[model samples]
Target: MMRIVVTGANGFIGRKLVRALLDQPSLSGADGAPVPLSDLRLFDVVPPEVPAGAADGPVTVRCMAGDLSDPAALGAVMNGGVDVVFHLAAVVSAQAEEDFGLGMRVNFDATRALLDACRQSAPDGAARLVFTSSVAVFGGDLPEVVRDDTAPVPQSSYGVQKAMGELLVQDYARRGFVDGRTVRLPTIVVRPGPPNKAASTFASSIIREPLNGEDAVCPVPAETGLFVSSPRRIVANLIQAATLPAARFGRDRTVMLPGLSVTVAEMIKALRAEAGDGAVARIRFQDDPRVRAIVASWPARFETARATALGFQADASFAEVIRAFVEDEMGAPHKDPVS
Candidate 1:
């Protein structure tokens, strides 16, 4: 039986990931045998809505809500030994940029504290830790297409925090403190629900709001492109990173997940294809230099040979991604699964 812990479990991706984990009968161990889940603890600042009847199932599901910055709160959540941990708590791009202090406390300080807790709790360093990093880690002067070997020159507070987190994960893995892996995720598009503080939130808002019969504002130019993954694919890749053998990551623990490079114009076109021009008409462009500057700094292309070879995948196209959000989140309608 395996005990797992998921931080930031209340988040959109975290909620979906937890449900996906519960759906799994068992996780594969290094020996290739099924490791039955005995207990699952979800930690966040807010209590996550657990899937109905999850506690009644074979796996014991527990939700702990409190600031991870508090050692006592974090310790209580990890009271029992944890076989696997997913660290997803963080401050988003725009928010982090706005409140550097808050970002430092949650994104940097809390992460370090969590790493220390994991180190102390699992002295043998057998814990499988999955840390979700971001493409924001790369900024300043970037190449046309970021590759496996590209060096991160972060330009924003959020990017700096994530870059620091990646280094911590790599160092912990090297010191045999934990079997850690980092997934450098792209801008996740079509995230369900209302907009967030992320500078990239508009990317989702433009599609999500209109599909819900509401108006949405796009702050960046139509020509601006982004390297993005859908929420579904991001969750899948995160799970894949956790299941793979530690040796598979080798010396570099950071895996840049695959994503689609779609311009704003192309994304809106996909929305039109699905909801017609009427839905497209609901979107308005309102340029903001601040948002544009921050978003534009992020690299919009990638060569993810490493993540691809490791069996990670991305969404096929923006149209399919929009359809997925409509079906899964909005309940608009279900389309055939894209290959």
Candidate 2:
């Protein structure tokens, strides 16, 4: 039986991932074989909401809440014999920029500590570890198309912290301490809830709020390009990453997930196509140079040949991303089945 631990299990992506794991109760081992999942441990700074159907599912779900920066709390997180670890916790881009110390403690220190915990325990074998990275890792002067082999030149504090995490995971994996893999994700759009502190939050607000019968603001210009993917595709790719044969990752063990390359004007066009002129009118353009500076630093296009070959995918179109929010969160009669 596979016992897995998911840090940051209460966040948006974390909650969705837990729900997906409950529905499919399994993960892929290093040998590319099925590993039946029997236990799930959810770790977060706050109490994690247990998945609704967890009691009836085949997997045992437990929520462990505490400040991970504390050594005792960190040790407890890795207490049980673990087969896999999914590290999803992080400080958002804008928030990290505002509070440098807080970001360093949470994003940088916590990640290194968690990795040490895995190296200390895992008596049975090297645990399969998935480190969630971001496209923020790439900034400064970049080529027209960012590739899997492109070098990282982080321009923000958050990006720098994530870049450090990526290297640590890579070196640890290289040393045989753990079977580690890193996934650098793009901007996720049409998030259901209110915006958080991420510098790219406006990317979602422009689409989400208008559909929810509220006005929204577009801080960047109409031509401002963004690399985005839907929550559906992100979740699917996270799960698929675990199932892939370890050898496919080679020495790099990092996959730059595919994302749609779109401009702000195109997103509004798609939104209007789905929700009509009223929804289009709900969006008001207001320039905020701070948000623009951070968003601009991120590359809007990537050559994700490695991820595609590994079977990860991107959302079909921006229209579909808006539709997904409606079907999944806006009370549509029929919901898309778990992919």
Candidate 3:
């Protein structure tokens, strides 16, 4: 029986990950699939809504709501016997840039404290730590195609903090304190729920707006290209990271995930194909230079051969991604083409 602790259990990716874990059948060992969630601990700022029949099973799911920035709170959670720690908590890009101090505290300082706590909790090496990094780590003066060997040139405070966290996780892993894997996720699109304050919030909004019969504004031009992965793909990669053999990852502690590299226009075209042209017409292009500049600085494409070789996969096209959102989150096929 493996004990798993997941932070940010209420956020977009976190919630979906937990649901998938809970629904998973019996897990395997080293030569097989991952071990099942016999004892699972979920921590977040807010309590997550567990599945209806979650409590009726053999797996014991415990929920803890607390501020990770507080040492005392983090200590209490880490004190529990934990085998796997999924560190997903962080301030998003736009919000982090807005409040530099808060970003530093929540993104960097708190993360360091958590890693230290993991070290202290399992002095004999008993846990696997998985950190959710972002593509924001790459910025300014990028080539046409970014590879795993690309030097990190973070442009925002959030990117800097996330990059720092990645270093810390790798260092801790190297010390044999915990088996750590850092995954650099692209902009996760078609995220469920209302829009967040992230600079990348528009990524989700562009899909969510039309689904709800509302119009959305594109801050960047139609030709603007970026890397995006659906929420399902993000969850799948996270699970793979947790289960992948450390020997397979080698010395490269960080991995860039696979995603669809498409322009805003292409994304709209896919949406229309799945939904309809009316939904596409609902999208209004209103350029905001500030947002455009921030997005433009990000890498438009990546060679995720490392992740693919490790058996991680992403959607083939933007339409497949949209259909995933519709099937998994929307609960039904699009009634209106715009929807």
Q: What is the C-alpha lDDT profile of model 1 across 1-339, one tens digit per residue?
A: 888999999888998889888988477776757899889999888887767779679999998998888988988987988888999988877789889999999999998888888888889998888999988788778899999999998888988999999999999999999888999998888888778777789999999999889999999999999998888889889888999988888899999999999999999999999899989999999999999997888899999999998989999899878877877897666565542
Give the least accurate 10-residue stretch of model 2, judged by summed lDDT: 330-339
**What TM-score should be assigned to candidate 3?**
0.92
Compared with the true structure, model 2 gives a TM-score of 0.94
In candidate 2, which residue ranges exceed 4 Å CA deviation?
Answer: 123-125, 334-338
Query: Largest lDDT belongs to which candidate?
Result: 1
lDDT (CA) for every model shown?
A: 0.89, 0.86, 0.83
The residue pairs in collision within model 3 are 275-337, 276-337
**Superposed Cα RMSD, model 1:** 1.8
State TM-scores per candidate. 0.94, 0.94, 0.92
For candidate 1, what is the lDDT? 0.89
Root-mean-square deviation per candidate = 1.8, 1.8, 3.2
